[model samples]
Target chain A: MNMMTGVSPWERLIRPDRVHGSLYTDPDIFEAELKNIWYRTWVYVGHESEVPNANDYVVKSIGPQSVIMTRDEQGKVNLLLNRCSHRGNQVCSFERGSARSFTCPFHSWTFANDGRLVGYAFPDGYEGQDKAQLALGRVTRVESYRGFVFGSFAADGPTLREHLGGAAETIDRLVRTSPEGEVEITAGFLKHRVKANWKFILENECDGYHPAFVHTSIFGVADSMIGKLYGGASTALTRDYGNGHTEIDLRPEFRKRDAPMSWFGTSEERLPDYTARMKAAYGDTAAREIMIDGTPHVMIFPNLFIAEIQMFVIQPLGVDDSVQHVTALQFKGAPDLNRRLRQQTMGSVGPAGFLLADDSEMYERCHRGVLARNPEWIFLGRGEKRQRQDELGFTVGHVTDEVPSRGIWTHYRNLMEPI
Target chain B: MLSRESSATLMSAITAFLYREARLQDEHQYEAWEKLWTDDGVYWVPANGADIDPERQMSIIYDNRSRIALRVRQLMTGKHFTQTPQSNLRRLISNIELMDEQPDDGDIAVASNSLIFESSLRDDTLWAARNEYRLRYVDGELRMASKKVILVNNDKAIYTLSFLV
Candidate 1:
């Protein structure tokens, strides 16, 4: 047998069937994940609508590396390392603003929006030096789909579209909800850190099983409010879309049947004159389709998540910690009252939201439990006995099952191992 | 013009109210705090320090009574996973000032500087906020119309603030 055989550390730590506890508590494994998965995959940076004009920039991170995504004077978006080429000083320290060029504070080295070396404070000492070879390092790949921008540190990975696969439809639906065919990242963001494994969040988001039990308080409140308003019972519906994507449909079911789309109050109670307003704005069917669909939440793998009413981005800070940044999106031509309603709803679902407070608390509890004794693995066998596949190559389970979380971990484990 | 005695009394009332609120929060007297707000009171924790508009700038916490009650219920629930290792907080409120009053709305705008020392099992956090309280007398009681908190480190990346700030 080989010297590094059956009892090897790698084999014992990670296997096709189970993952070791060290994956959650070990710093070394965390570092490897940062380098291999976060740096290699297409990580979401920001949205094009965030920097609508030339020279607008936003700061974000991929792993531990700080990066600035900017719209150049030529209207092309570029993602550049925030570090200065000389002495590794941070090039753009501001969180976000409109600037033609960023000047390093340490040595006064300046870089344009496209990350070109524009000017230097003092040129006497560097007369003979090669300035062309010393430009701000650019990201390997910077791509955008439906106005959402993403950057990858690796050069040889699959194209952004290929990486997204069947997930692009969700993005399309998000943008399509607006008659303008685009969405912008709204001003202001809710930034908070959760003391839990980053993967736990991604797994829990589409996990429909946790709501009925984990969010009993939310359901109670919803029952009181929803019952009073609609005189119906609220139901949480979970559907598994192929390619590691899932959707959670939360709609009130009345009279022992899924309430018709009209009862949810799209055109009747919420917007009594919605049809007339739509005709005055975008015509007839356009308004009906955009306003009526009831799907609320969508998740794009590796860290981009969206709710029809809210937008959020999750960035891994450490092995056992992650930062969740939330923004509320608004239609460009949406009325002030509609925008305020959206903002109120978004705030109710944000970090301080009734639902999120419980979710975050649960994440902390999970983190505490995982750090407990010498357990080799955490079980993901909720629906293993009934793992059924559909047309999309995805598995389905009961509304309150851990099937989606299991799928997330399965994909995560696959991406973690070397190909 | 108001007499110096009246002004001092008003200041004392404002300072006492602020201290009482902090004490209630530290003691987890959430239900009592809920009673201090008007029916339509808004609690806002601005994401940017100098933001003038809550509509345009993001806030850390913006909740009304209903949402605040919901949060209280969740915290009391056994399934609130994040609160497993419950967080303990101590707040220091000082530099109280009665800035201005709107005669038309009968609203008194009071500003105070505050520092909160929060401790979880693994981390200790320090937060400094400039708080503005818009108070109005309703039915002979001083009730808050809006409470706005602007943190000094507003624009910086932050950890989860799972409680009222």
Candidate 2:
């Protein structure tokens, strides 16, 4: 807490077992996080399927900055800052649409969907101003892995693949669920606003510890097997895949029951055509394994959450406010399954979800509780002594442990303190 | 089309039904509210836009008859923490109009505009929506065959909308 000392705040505040409460409430710390983490990392923009045709675009936010994901004439995805070069008015205002070019309403400066400044209203205003240089600002890098687009502001850093590390396989797992080996994010998102820090969502999404207590009501009313799935009785594991990524692996639990498609509460018999298609796509062995393994429950650092049946993007609005945009994951070739996915997504996520409503309340209460500042730290030491590294060198722990939280903090400290 | 006198009487009956339904929701009368629905009732609240395929697009709330029963059961459990203290709610219904065309099932189509005010956990939220309803008679009593709520801000980030819309 002493300012005279030369030690960085992260060094002083982030311990092995706990983190400072100010991480959730301090405005200065939040600002620092924006600079060190969000602005510098490969933040997910949107999936390629969102804009399938040329000139299609969707507006999204990376940290606090607005950006547009567009598909241009060549069917290539482009990420450009929404700011117009003329006077900084946001060029595209609509959430999603198709337009070959964006014209700034203030001065009528137009730019192509691929970030080219094409025209302006008046000719006498400027003679030698370089139109090429005046194009809409773009991220330093934009990369895609399995159609998931990510943009970064920092020009010099680890490549998106390097940043994804072991988490790339998690994304692959999500895409692999499709019979055609591709996923479509065409279903519109459900944005859930919460009165809490963004980190709470990052941690809670893959926490694996709060379900039995925080969601007992839902489990009780629905007779959900989630309690047994993550209640120290199942064989599920929580993993920290380094680089701020984490996962709650339920494959082991599903495999133990030998119930294929049980993760979705359905069986192969219920979806005969889907079953046939899966086998035809990947053969019997791989398809059976894929069905048993199911979709992933993973947090891909700084922003993206590939939850089992859906995808969530956590955008931080302020120190104590955030919005989670959620969408149901749809497969490329499975119509029957896609419908079920939509229904299940309605049942479990979003602002009015049966399960997430309670979670949002808890987040608000946690933010309010942390604001008290009576307790200087939030404990995260569960299973720290017993967590082990799997064959992939990723840290693994019990389903009821704080392995994911500790993982997030460890990588967070590394980034905030850069060395 | 019905005669003017019959239309007036039907309008009065429909108005009464809507008011009673609104009161039951505001009072948290879960049992009574559940009873207002026919055996095959459908409740839908579409997201992003009102004209969408619920089976293809994500919805805020889409419940078939069985799911409706499950939803009411969940609300009544008293353990659904989101509604633990329950929201203090009041809604005003206006601009009720009988739509043209009676369906083959003897259901009357009605449309109305509403504004709901909910005060909970020291936070206040105002919700505005246009509602469409299909009403039919079952056992000599009026019942809801289907209800669709289209919120004005369906495309924006929504806070906890745990209560019935």
Candidate 3:
């Protein structure tokens, strides 16, 4: 285990109570993380709804690498490296578009959206050069879980389902919230940058400890009753789903808010109609459970978070900066419900929203403070001992516990440490 | 389009109003800025396409008059920790032009560009936007009927935009 100190590097760096500051600031560690964590894990690309029609494509990135998620002529989704094989130029330029082929602007080395090299100028320039082999570098593995596409770069590892673990049921419940058992990415997305490390944003997503403090202004300034209801939610919990995923669930009363698409809570007026419809489809118990479950905030490790009808895709830019892409999801069959969802998303977590603004400021402050080098250890000792493994083998903790972040560190150490 | 002289005068008047509004924002005059809006005013900043409906699509900022006031109220309160030290701002407004007018409704539309210089603790940022404002003459005073801000960095990853720009 030891080269210099005769002890595992992670043993000293990542403890149950704390993680070293270098985990957030070291350039070499960031690179190592990209290779071991991001590259090795199953990474979400784009939802199938984003590329609904043939030839429609959207660009997605993991750290420094950009990839295209496209629906080819066959209507199957393909995840291909955006880099052109010939000159390493990005194959597709637009954010999302319907295109037959992605032509590299550098030398016009055109490849079909399916990762097939169909044509190139001066094909005989290098006679017998295998164009098929030279197609856009396809990711090692690509799979879709209910239209949510994900890709992995490593040649071998866990399958997408294996990678997801208990997070699968959470996702299943998420998409099933749609009356039609489907949802679409309708309202587009809001891309924001944070001045701190990428992990900070991910941790902040389910950090049940901060909302009461960080979003206090939101409660104070809100004119609507729903804000007050959220402000009044006294009980909360953060569940550690197996395989590094976390779910932060608030008390059932909070989900009792009388808003349409009330992921947090539902009211009596709309409950009858919603429950009636759901009962007709899945019976009373399932419908009631869904109603009571409210909105579940699920975080799929390395970087994907879905909560409150929105999805967050995080990209690490450097040791000190990260890009956060937020998309508002809409119910497929419920136009009115979709409208409400979009409005709620707009009011909450975008760049200027009541929540994200405070969080970003905190992130930057943390970044600044971490540079001090004197504090050495960042205390995560919040409710460490109270956390325990659940019946499903998950480590569960109360909302105020550092359980989620600890899970992240545990997973990070597992991935980064030598086998 | 109005006559050249009328358009010029309209531009000048609207320019002064906008500059005053910018100054109010920079000074963090929440109450005064709230007074600049018509009761039915809408403040919208589209996230994706400039023309997308803020009601049905994701927007950076979309506020009815009431919510706008509430937003300003929140920022004015010390609880909005992002502005604890209060972000320092200076805006440069240019290319003010009378783009459209609805005489019957007593409304006029103008277009302009903005470059907002913002500074906070240990950091500084420059924000650029194409601003379109619908001005309504109410009670013999021109008030903001609606403001649509098309941020230049809308498509990119941006940090906090808590303060008014």
For this target, which candidate reaches the highest lDDT against the unseen true structure?
A: 2
Candidate 3 local lDDT, residue A138: 86
Docking class of 3: medium
- Residue-level lDDT tens digits of model 3 in A31-61: 8888888788898877899999998988888
How good is the docking of model 1, as DockQ? 0.53
Off by over 4 Å in 1: A1-3, A6-18, A224-268, A272-290, A336-341, B65-86, B100-104
TM-score per model over all chains = 0.88, 0.98, 0.94
After superposition, candidate 3 runs with Cα above 4 Å error: A223-233, A251-279, B1-9, B100-104
Model-by-model DockQ, in order: 0.53, 0.76, 0.78
Q: Could you say which candidate leads in TM-score?
A: 2
lDDT per residue (tens digit) for residues B1-165 in model 2: 799999999999999999999999888899899999999999999889899888788888989988887788878988778888899999999999998766777799999999999988728999999999999988888899999999999998889888888
Poorest lDDT segment (10 consecutive residues) of candidate 2 chain A: A1-10
Q: For candidate 3, report its TM-score.
A: 0.94
What clash pairs does model 1 have?
A193-B159, A193-B160, A209-A400, A361-B81, A361-B82, A362-B81, A362-B82
Tens digit of per-residue lDDT, candidate 2, span A37-86: 88888898899999999999999989878899999999989999999898
Candidates ranked by TM-score, best first?
A: 2, 3, 1
Task: Compute the interface RMSD for candidate 3.
Answer: 1.3
lDDT of 1 by residue, A239-281 (tens): 4554355655443232233332232333334544433554456
Q: Is candidate 1 or candidate 3 better by DockQ?
A: 3
